[model samples]
Target: MNLSPLQAISPVDGRYRNTTQDLAQYFSEYGLIKYRVFVEIEYFIALCDINLPGLTAFDKANYNKLREVYLNFGETDAQEIKDTEKVTNHDVKAVEYFIKKKFDDLGFPDFKEFIHFGLTSQDINNTAIPYTFKLALNEVYYPKISSLIEKLKELATAWKDVPLLAHTHGQPASPTKLGKEFLVFAERLEIQLNSLKTIPNNAKFGGATGNFNAHHIAYPATNWVDFSNNFVNNTLGLNRAQHTTQIEHYDQFAAQCDALKRINNIIIDLDRDIWTYISKNYFKQKIKEGEVGSSAMPHKVNPIDFENAEGNAGLANALFEFFAAKLPISRLQRDLTDSTVLRNVGVPMAHTVISISSTLKGLNKILLNEEVITADLENNWAVVAEAIQTILRREAYPNPYEALKDLTRTNQKITADTMAVFIDGLKISAALKEELKQITPYNYTGVF
Candidate 1:
């Protein structure tokens, strides 16, 4: 079968391919080959700049031409490298061989040997993956999520004065403003985004055993550690891990996953809250003409966007949990487990993108049902008991908490008249009774 979106197995590559196509340039097989080629070429160029013994004759003017090998890399080049990998059975080695062939075609056979000098498969794999991963986040993920945060801020600011009947333990409690509630999520997301910024995009660039053994053995006088650090950090814009066995230690990778999981959890929290709000009839969705809410029910308008966002966020978090717990561990120095697991990094990212998009869609669909909301506030007169009790306590009244609790905890439905009657019978003075009556659920919302 031709591998089109319809034929692909994973929904990310199939049903939702359009939602996550931006990630293809960072995590696809072709993307991996392209990055591997980039790292190999750049490493060779850096060596030329360093005056490595046999590389002094390399023409600096041809550097642009060398860079073009990867910068202008295309599908044909990627497929050729795949063909080479079929024979070598080593992906990174195949990338090196492909670069060597490019050098021969470019008429630089004398300099081709330095293309991947003194590097292991992990050196290339680790460096390329981290660099590409950072780009994907900075370019795609951050912008998408930040857009959601901005939308939330917009909602919060716009609805700041809209009173909300707050619920605690699924029962009416104190009242809060709608806008202030959204600010809660904006605050959480901002904190997580800051944490993500603190973590450096890290990679491992040492030779065989994280010691640069081959490079050191070849050039004892050279400062290989400083060289690798500068090349990985300054050149590639990633921090190089100083020590490892045969592969990147993956501690930072785990940290990245944990941070992202916390972010996804926050999004899930937002989804669930919005879903609940819609269920409670506090909000109505905009009618998209011809959109079906249910197969049979004509009056139904389901909160499917929030539901979709919640499900995808959950899926993303599960993979993130596995990544956080599993990637940092290796069976005595190295294992094949990380290799296979690492490839799926894009899967969680795709889900996250889809979830954020769903959330954005849901946010845009919301049309405040003020009639229903106002009716809820008007009906829940007992919610103002906390405000009345606090005022009575401020007036030095005795047993104020017990007074309001006894009035509110009854089986009888508390109305404005019921509260007024109860307050009139209170042991407090007339001024205090007047103050207690002033409290109403609609205006009793806490300061935003």
Candidate 2:
């Protein structure tokens, strides 16, 4: 029972470990502990900068030495903290003791007491969690999403001129460019992404119970609010939540979750559409020499890639929804509910990464069946009836909609020849009849 990828309980660490291992640096236990140590060290440095009482005369030359506690943090350092956690039974306090131990080893025993002075565990946990989350998005999540969008744009641009029989209400309605359809999802994703960027990576920094209870009591004359703001914002590059309970209000965090869910939803939409396209033979998946689509069906080249993306997107969104709904609520000034839930923040993100990667793989494998796409357009010539009818309306033709409806709905197979015959039979002038006859599914894709 040694620890290995196969022994992991969650698929993020088990089956898809390689796909999501990049996130381990942000949301793993070691990542959180490392962040806690970082925040404590930086807080001590910030106190030195402010010339806070006894800490004012602290040596500036040891700043880099203090930073090295977390900068050179590694598996050994993490193991030491975990070992410390075993003794203290408090994760953040373990980080405090670990940093103090590092200070003691650095021969700065007098400076060790200020490592976590006047702060509750939440101050460390909340700040470290948000900071880690923000860095994960900037360093990992956003880049993945942007890469997907860029892939979509490439395909959309490549297929911009290809006409597709558009489906509305489960019926062929009009002709649209294949690229325009993809652009819809791309545009939607980009909009939500812009909004996601605006949301502050906020953290709860007050000592305990939302007020600087310990902070104010320790230094009554000092402006702890402004000090906390500067430390959280300028020092840590995160927004300080002005009001809170024992933890962050999580309103902005919930907003971030909702925004990620929105992006996942857009990918889900694209997955279903591409799956349908593959089903309809508009896309033929590239087959590996020995790949099996199904064990029983020898000829099946199924749309499994899009299906995988869709399934993972669904899972990601579900967890993201829970994060949005559950993180923003607590019993009172504090509760233990969000603690365990927050630990899984990387789970949804990992799934999202796997899903998007699947989607990209699916997109790359698609060999467009132009023959099938064009044949579909040809078979659905009845779609041109709208264009003809609209033109007839412009010409003041009597009952144009009724006329096209009667002509198209009778179901005598609205092929090219039949459409031509119907156009020739119209009471309009020959020139107008010829003009109406020119409308076809291929040429009817409107301008962008």
Candidate 3:
């Protein structure tokens, strides 16, 4: 079938295409070919700059022309490569042939042999994938998630003084500020983001194996190790693995997945909490005209955005866990497994982007029902037992814990009148009783 969003197989490309469209330039097959062409062209130009014997005659003026092959790479160019792949039966070799044809057209046919000289398919695949992956995270993922954190900060500051009854073990416990709860997520996201920054975008760039065997054999006197390091690290701006098999070790990539999984978990936690708050009537979502929350119930306005976020983030977390575990292992020298799995890197990322967008939407739609929150605090007056017990302990009252426990553990609800009557009957000074009476759920919120 001719592909449109509706006709696409995966929802990442179908139902949620708009949410993940930006990633097309980084993870799509066209994107992979474009990046391979870029690396090959840059490697050739770098060889020319180093005064490599065969490439010394390459014209410097045509460097921009070479760069344009990728900079202005179009669908036609990618299709041509794909057609070549059908004949060559090797994707990387097709990329090589396509670049060689571009060199011939650029009038540098003599220097075309230096295009993929002394490099393996892994060199191009590993370098190109990491290069684009880093760009995708920086350009797309970081900005979206950073905005979510900023939104949390905004909400936290706006509701900084709003009192919320804390729940422990599904029972009313101490009181907490609504804003402080929002701030907790922001703090967690920022810490994980910092850790994600520390991990290097690693790549493998040696020849066929971890060693520059071909390059060293061709130029025995030249330091090919330094050459590879400079090309992979300084030129391309990635970390070169000093040792590898036919492909990258992907250790740092696994670390990256683990870090992202933690981030997704935090987002899932926030989704569940916000969903609970909505269910408790502590948050009311702004209803849009003509929007249906439920088909049968007209008054229904579901917390669908948070629910969507929770589901997508959970799916992304599962994929991330698998990537972390699977990418680090290969049979002996190498296997085809990593290649197949690597193609789906965009799948989890697409889900993650969708979840982040959904969360931000859910947050924007929420309208806090402060009166409901306040009523909850007022109804849960027994939470003040802890404060009363602590104050009684300060006075060195005997059996203070047992005293408050006895008063609160009764079947009757602990309302303001109930506590007041109990305080009036206490065998303590009137001044101390008055001080204890001041403790209420609203004002008992601890310092953030």
TM-score per candidate, chains pooled: 0.98, 0.98, 0.99
Tens digits of per-residue lDDT, candidate 2, 1-448, equal 5679989999999999998999999999989888988999999998888888888768899899888888999988999889988999888888888888888899999878888888888889889999999999999988988998998899999999999989998899899999999899889989999999999999988887978888788888888899999999988899999988888989999999999898899999999999998889999999999899998999998888899999999999999999999999999898999999999999999999999999998999998899999999999889999999899899998999998899899958889998898888888898998888888899899995
Error of 3 at 396 (Å): 1.2
- In model 1, residue pairs whose N, Cα or C atoms come closer than 3 Å (at least 3 residues apart or on different chains), thus clashing, are none
* TM-score, prediction 3: 0.99
- On lDDT, who's better, 1 or 3? 3
Query: All candidates' lDDT scores?
Result: 0.91, 0.90, 0.93
Q: Name the best candidate (by lDDT).
A: 3
Q: Residues 206-283, candidate 3, lDDT per residue (tens digit)?
A: 888778888989888888878888988999999999999989999999999999999999999999999999999999
Q: Give the Cα error of residue 357 in candidate 2, in Å.
A: 0.8
Tens digits of per-residue lDDT for model 1 on 1-448? 5699999989989998999999999999888889999999889989988999999988899999999999899999999999988999988889999999989999999988887898889899899889988999999999999999999999999999999999999998789999999999999999998899789888998887888889999899999999999999999999998888888888898899899999999999999999999999999999988899899999999999899989998999999999989988888867889888888888999999999999999999999988888889888999998898888788888888998889888899999999999988988778777877888998898777
Lowest lDDT 10-mer window, candidate 1?
427-436
Per-prediction tally of clashes: 0, 0, 0
